[model samples]
Target: MTTPSGPTVPFALARFATDAGSVPGLVVGDRIRPLSPAELGAPSLNEFLAAGEAAWDRIAALAAVASDASHSDGTTADAAWRPLEAVTLLAPVEPRQVLQTGANYRTHVIDLVAAGRAKDDPRPIEELREWAAELMDRRAREGIPYFFIGLPACVVGAEEVLELPDYSEQHDWELELAVVIGSPAFRVSREDAMAHVAGYTIVNDITTRDLVFRQDMKDIGTDWYRAKNAPGFLPTGPFLVPARHIADPGDLRLTLTLNGETMQDATTGDLLFDIPALIAAASETMPLLPGDLLLTGSPAGNGIAHGRLLRDGDVMVGTIEGLGSQVVRAAAARVPA
Candidate 1:
């Protein structure tokens, strides 16, 4: 119900995770200080997000000061706040529901179908486009929007392990730009959608392609969370760059690295649905809360299309130009056989 305010924050910002050791960080006045657990005092980003706009503004102000001082002389002070590593990167917002879109990117759709990763179902595409156009128009008039959900437990932060489950051999990685809701939004208009966004982060919507398509064909209930929620399946975050800091979400660069090789690279402009549409579609179902996260679909070059599955010890990295990035490692799940 609260009107969203601008971030009023700058880049070169990050919330330190208290649980991660070695809190050493670059201080406000261009000084690098080793942070002991006691010296590190900021709550987790998830906590700060829950604190609402007033607290967000304060946090933004402090980050802005530090960001400004870091680049005081035109030299970029690029230091990763160790504290971010300590906290388990929860979903940007703790939304009661999480919604993701399908075929939101043209290339993602075309490439998947061409590679036999997705079915050549023109009917679904036609329905979705019409649905999207209608939703877009509806959002222009009213404040309510449509959106979807991802499983809550399907989230993991930077440097975390993505354990590929033993049930399937079709694990895939999707590089997506995730939007975190800052304020309460219900039936929110597109003009107001961005206002409700607190910031942006990176998400790897890891999935089991074979399982998903097979389930989709049966007309049964969705198997999305089941295939996507394997332990450590959702690798997110190294930082959450407040929305104000980003000049334009559409203009940002998105890239993903598997092991040391770069696999996917694109931008938000390539999104078929875009952020505003996704927001509108989502708000139609439920009120997007402070911590709700909306993941814009990924770009071309997924592992599935190329037949490359992750192995133990593979490192995965995802980055969005202004929003910082995340690094996740992969390994076999440790289960008692």
Candidate 2:
């Protein structure tokens, strides 16, 4: 339905292993709004999304009123109305847990080391030390160094803008491919791991760049988690498109623009570890459940280290080839005067 602000759409709220259902929703001027859960034949918000694509049709019907306005190019005549900004964009999935990979892009690694943030060898220092003696004996080999983690509170949604806290000065932005789990999977084979995927969306893994590098030493738990999990660290979506539609996860054209200048531009192929490898490696340990999220990491050329950290009123927009785009405003953590 259309609100005084603009046309709206039924935005879905997804969950796993729970009775929550999708709620009726509308996109009122740049925001995704829930119409009413009960009206969609579901008891709870998560339950409605769990109903699957069929429910999406019904949810789309909720937007029928707005969509019928006879406009060109999937937009309406109201220049001031942007449905994506009006409603509170909730994380589409209720991930039992969230897992992310570090330094998965080959070019990103090269650039990182050039920037003096990462070591040249992907192997950990301890492993390097162990292999040093063996190298003298002529049997040393290099290996990929990967870091994985379960970031519980590092979740937010499409419409929400992140607040950079005062205590931190080194804020950063990472544009990643966020995968939503569709089924329960554990130690799944590469071919099968993708079957567990629910869909894909964009993720801006906002990081505290200074904190990331300050605690860059080995074996010690840097307060990176706290800095990483700060409120609004992760902002995702405009919507989640089913995997069936994305023919090649590795070929998508991705771009990140800060304020208005393009800051990062690269394809998913730049990834050192492709999507399947990441899925297989992650599932080897934790049981990935439907709605669980995985962030595929970002590429080279981000703010913070590469450029200037984001500032108040700075607008960051992330766009993927097929997937829709999302915009975030960088405002000081205070009520605008």
Candidate 3:
């Protein structure tokens, strides 16, 4: 299919339907061009990304040539060009490891702390704000990024339905920018971190609020596994935009709407620890492998902060500046009698 004359996006790697089944494809405008078996070499997106930087460069070059040819021909229809809507969009890549940052956004942390303190303190809002600001400042200066492991079994496609666990009532949404690793990283410095990133994708880190803290074992602290690792808890990807396409990861906007009402709207600029810092911190303990995902923490205005948690039949639309949007439906978890 011929494309319109404009700035051609090199490629937006995606997995879509083909005659044999779903395969990795390169997205150009509204159509998808399935990667041939030879081109794929690797069976899955995970393996494809792990094939190294030269592999991605080759794909991008091939995509650029096709895009240029399409522009020159100006043809609108081709058998190879399938409309994006017609194909099933799967999670761009199945990461071997999923690591999520906790309390990485300044405003998100401030809001939670302020709300918790408001229950006991008689101070005014301004006073609380002042105290919270000081606390965050100190944390930024002294604290390192806190990260937790996430199970890859919980990941689902962009349009997948999320079954709210029956054990929890306060299901919530946490829209975040998920970083995709291109190369292995071990105890890497912040200066060399960007080189390891393949691209960016959106991940809605759905959490069950009531399950976050272990009531019976307070000393153990948060139980992210139970609260977050439910099947389909992570709705990820419509596209994995190449890191080169995004000018600055720290400057993108993130927003989420529940049933058409905007809930969380913030920018990566508010992040207390940016991508490079988060990468460095996470790699300090373990190696970050190719196709691994690092979820930068969500911004403020989550269900806990707004008192409007997710409910069955709710539709959440999460959007990040250049990464694209994800629409997921909430369903009641079925329990066997």
Candidate 4:
């Protein structure tokens, strides 16, 4: 196996549905080199990822070969490679465990706090923002990332639609950068965290605003189990860009548009707790197995902050720099006739 020629020659990992079954592939430009059972030892990314970083290194090397061959003579003798457009793109990884860091973005938390202020409050927007900024700084200095578990069943590929549950009109969108874990992590230090990461992908954590908190149990706090666990709620991936390709995860830009209008425009620089911090903190209590996901929180500019929740027929297009784009359509859950 050969290593990637250089970081400039980009490569992504993806999954596609074939007549035989689901197949994981190496993405080079517009073409794909599908993996065989002998290549990765499994048909699923989750299982293959369990083989760990060496497996990933081998794949990257193969991608480099494919990348060079694709540009060199315009044709390769290997029949395994196919056009990306000819296949259906599935979620890049089948995470055995999915954990999300909540309110990790400095500005997003501040915006939510400011927006929640009562209309009768005498404080001006400038004062509120200053106070929020200080609060965020304090959190970053003294606090660790807040994490919550998510059901894997809620995950769906980019080809799926976001079926807005009829139970709540307060449906909202939160586009985020997701970490795909490779090496096992257990009580690892912050400095060693990145070594465990396999790559990154995009996930839109849809929520039912009304179901986020229980009316009768105010002291018990947020009900994330109900608020964020809807089927098709977590629409993920056109592809997964291995960590080697991303120059710096913290320097990437995130953009999401609702029905062709920009709703979220921010950068990873706004994150209060970086990826390493999140991984280190989360793995402290539990063993993070291969192919598990750790989602960095969303940046500012969600539906509730703008008072413009998702609606039927609304198309949500989310893109994170170098991670590819996701186009998810929201619609009212149809009742059976």
Candidate 5:
């Protein structure tokens, strides 16, 4: 029912539910212990993250105590520490706002540009790739990232089933490294953006490829609301590793496998605009509150690029280095018999 840990020594934070209710918890190795809100003086993870870098240190102190209290030698910890497998893990954070980036990966955008070429154009795929790569390089040097807003209502835990909307059959998977905001950021510069990050997590940004473009209004661009806001479309987190535990967010590896086949395998470094730029750009127009998610964009190897879309009973397992991993399955909605 539940799962939980991380890269450096394997420790992290997450929300879990039991028969009593739900609580935020610290996971060390294969065991977990709750961090009561009253004790931390913060009602939820949003408040806790709003506490800024201090919250991480406070959680560190809690981890020490939890580890001490959880000694296996039959103590009151019998109820305090539970095996990681016995709990139900929820989406690590309940973000008020989710800023999603599009085509921010260098190679990814090149792949997309090459994929969308007109059939009449006689350029070879390799040559087209080269031209697109040059264009992406130019954009990286002189461009801001393409961003879209996402609904938090779509957030769901990794274990949840994905009911593919029958309205479109071109659903795709895009696993990415999600930055968890700590302090409120408004118009912050790129140099100062990293300070506002509380931690990191994995998000599978599932999309309906065909619904992305506006069919009715041909002039209008992508319609993210209809294309991306399906229930359980954003499958997030098995754990939220504190920023302190991650050496470098830009260098982390992101991987997603579908039904045992590798779909996306890339590193955050492939992003045309890195995490700091994303945070700075996203926060420039609006305030990014604590617990908000800033997605750093997805890499290449998407269904649109591959032409192989999701089907009923397809399973996806997404992982990010240092943060954690998530497992999700797609199930088509059934009609009444």
Candidate 6:
């Protein structure tokens, strides 16, 4: 299951079942190679990532040797290679921190603002469009990216079922590209931001639409914590494709389908602030640790823009070019009396 040049193999780290229980594995073509305790040195992908670049280099080297040996012996089948379908895919990594960007996609922001104005404004349609365009242009030049912290405890594997909170009726889906930090980063420049990235993964940034704004305090604006950080709110991964495998993160296409219908589809090219900008912006005040996740915002066609909020029994399928896809099913909340 290993590749001749392990570094070139583009491994997707995951956790799958073992006689002893679940263990971290490196996903190769149609099989997974379990990591030994000596190789892993830790139980989770989070620790593996924090072990530094040298640890990853060693993994790649070992994989390359295994691959070479397998090919040379003419016995490519090894017991270590387990069927991919038989294994359970856990969240690729347990992030130390989760950072998410808001209103970072050009079309998504414009659509939201325009939709709000259409509901209550008396301005002409064309005038409203003109104003929105102008506003975006000025904001791009003068504004910085808006970021919010998310609770890592809310993260779940892609295959896990989503449980809706009883208090919110308007649960929504936001498909975004998530960046996994490879090294410690603080006050990093945009020019050198890409180097700090270890890999890319998929994240469905689910939101409670009704709770986004505090009705009790209008001036307080958005309440991201309450609205976005619920258990199973963030369904992430199926794979974490190495950054080296992704030539350009900004050019990847992202698509999301809800119950067999394509709801959100867009490319990363539409991002108002690209990956480098987001990394630089996020690292300005806080240090980004290995395995930390930074979500680069969602594109247009979210439920908020289309009036098609998620409901119980809804199934969401999110896909990002190069990284992989994630399917999450939603269920009604089981509230206790």
What's the TM-score of each model vs. the native? 0.73, 0.72, 0.91, 0.92, 0.93, 0.89
Q: Judged by TM-score relative to the true structure, which candidate is superior, 1 or 6?
A: 6
In the order shown, the candidates' Cα RMSDs to the true structure are 7.8, 7.8, 3.7, 4.4, 2.5, 4.2
lDDT of 3 by residue, 307-334 (tens): 8898889988888887767888899988
Which runs of model 6 end up more than 4 angstroms from their true locations?
Answer: 1-9, 17-21, 41-44, 51-53, 62-76
Candidate 2 is scored at a TM of: 0.72
Task: Tell me the spans in candidate 5 whose CA falls farther than 4 Å from its real position.
Answer: 1-10, 68-78, 334-337
Predicted structure with the largest TM-score when compared to the true one: 5
Q: Once superposed on the true structure, which residue ranges of model 4 sit more than 4 Å away at CA?
A: 1-9, 41-44, 71-76
* Model 3: ten consecutive residues of lowest lDDT: 1-10
Off by over 4 Å in 1: 1-9, 12-56, 64-96, 117-148, 215-217
Each model's lDDT: 0.62, 0.65, 0.83, 0.83, 0.84, 0.81
Order candidates by TM-score, high to low.
Answer: 5, 4, 3, 6, 1, 2
Q: Candidate 3 at 324: error in angstroms?
A: 1.3
Give the clash total for candidate 4: 0
Candidate 4 lDDT over 173-289, as tens digits, reads 999999998879999999999998888889999988888878798899899999999888788886877787788999999999988899999999999999889989999999998
Tens digits of lDDT, candidate 1, 24-135: 2322322222333332234443444555557556654555655665544634454443333234443333444556766666565666655652355555655655555555
As a TM-score, model 5 comes out at 0.93
lDDT of 6 by residue, 1-337 (tens): 1111111234666666568876778766555788886787666666667666676776777656656656543335567776666776777777889999999888888888876774667888678778887887788888899999999998888777898888878899999999999878899999999888888888999999888889998999999999999888989886777777789888999999888799889999988888999999999999999899999999998998888888888888888887667888889988731
Candidate 4 TM-score over all chains jointly: 0.92
lDDT of 2 by residue, 45-138 (tens): 4454455566557655655555566376667653533455334445655566788778766556555544553455687655554554343223
